[model samples]
Target: MEYREVELPACKSIALIAHDNRKASLVAWCARHREALAQHRLCATGTSGALVAEDTGLVIERLVSGPLGGDQQVGALIAEGKVDLLIFFWDPFEPMPHDPDVKALLRIAAVWNIPVACNESSADFIVASPLFAGRSQRMVPDYERYTASRSAR
Candidate 1:
């Protein structure tokens, strides 16, 4: 399916991430919205990306493995204003060794004023919003500033 650019702020770039356990749910969810999601750019971490691509037949920009810095890479994309939406189906119940990176990714989205969906419910909320059909410009902080702050600390 060819997903054209929609009006939503996140329609420009959408990041798809899911933990090992939640990969299936994420895949299932994406399959349900394949048509809508196809309208935007899709990115994902190594394993997750591979799995999703295999399951849904969507070409995804694959990054490194999450525990191996994939999450940080995607987070950098968000900080750099390259990503507009983040859909991360994380398993909060399990402790991840790379939790810090994941948290940082989510925080970067927040710091940059981008919309992020951490769970299935929020993903639905974001995808269903009329704004998803209308492109809206949002003021975001400078990527340099965020990087500088982290460096300073």
Candidate 2:
């Protein structure tokens, strides 16, 4: 597939997601980074969003519950280039009924070439990076080129 560069604005649109078992940890992490995170646009799956907002007092756009299609919502936003970063704290030990949705969300984040942090350590590193607070470029699939090539076949 062909690729092209896209810019991520300094004030990025960040998506947060956390499994039931990891919600507390995610909330704590958010609280720790509250000051830094306040500068960005934040969204999350329902319960996690509420918890984070309550604990950190940071505004968050809440979507449906994860099992109720929140993961897909975030994935769609990522695909549309509306989300610049993903901070998902999923539990590896527990089995989720909507596991396919979780996998698909992660897959789409990779496809869109967005920065993703699946755990607190990675999230901390990403937040601490210079790129996180400044404009940055990322290579993504050149969809128009791929479509044109396919149409010419």
Candidate 3:
């Protein structure tokens, strides 16, 4: 696929998601980074968002629960260039009924060339990165070019 460069603004739109078993971990992580997170926009699956907001007092845009299509919602936002980062705290030991949705969300984040942190350690590194503080550039699929090429086939 053809790709083009895009700039992520200084204030990014971050998406948060967590499986049932990992919700507390995600909330604690948010509380730990509350100050840095406050500077950016946060959105999360329904339950996770509410927990984080209640624990850290950070404003969050809540979407439907993950099992109920919240992962797809965040994926759509990523595809639309509205979400810059994805922080998902999913449990690997436990099988999830909504595993497909989780996979799709991660796939979309990769396709969009956005950063994703799947655990607390990665989340810490992501938030502490120098690029996290300012504008950063990333290459993403050039959908229009891809469409035109397909049309020429």
Candidate 4:
């Protein structure tokens, strides 16, 4: 008899990024995990977001393209704890002019303790984790409260 393990889907705000050449792979991966990913909020760079959104029929909050600061925008979200996970499919074989931005975004994710997936395998590991039990990360202590408290001090 074969044993089957069940992975609890976690509700996570995820950022999806891919280079132009890898958009197709990203889309395919998203399609395979659409059911799980759909339970969470999706944010993506313009082109990758469009591709994933189209492929999975899931709504993605789109940001500017990577070269146009989309990576920074998502990085800010991670820094503020707005995002839970990041899946970036970069073409390491090819050098990108926007490499700095990519590195910055990746660095920010690390600083914020956000999980990142640079390939399909890593993505599978994340989506299959017990922590991801189809539960959303609480957004407590709203931004307004934090800002107000800081101002009072």
lDDT of each: 0.84, 0.97, 0.96, 0.82
Model 1: per-residue Cα lDDT over 24-123, one tens digit each: 9899989888888888899999988998889888879999999999999999998666888899999989999998998898888887777888888999
Q: lDDT winner between 3 and 4, please give it.
A: 3
Q: How do the predictions measure up, each by TM-score? A: 0.84, 0.98, 0.98, 0.81
Q: Write the per-residue lDDT of candidate 3 for residues 67-133, one digit (tens) a residue.
A: 9999999999999999999999999999989999989999999999999999999999999999997
Give the runs in model 1 whose Cα sits over 4 Å from its true position. 1-10, 142-153
Off by over 4 Å in 2: none
The residue-level lDDT of candidate 4 at 103 comes to 92
Task: Write out the backbone clash pairs for model 2.
Answer: none
lDDT of 2 by residue, 74-113 (tens): 9999999899999999999999999999999999999999
Number of clashes recorded per candidate: 5, 0, 0, 7
Please give me the total number of clashing residue pairs in predicted model 2. 0
Stretches off by above 4 angstroms in model 4 are 1-10, 134-153
Candidate closer to the true structure by TM-score (higher is better), 2 or 4: 2
**Candidate 3 local accuracy as lDDT?**
0.96
Where is the poorest 10-residue window by lDDT in model 1?
A: 1-10
Give per-residue lDDT, candidate 4, residue 80: 74
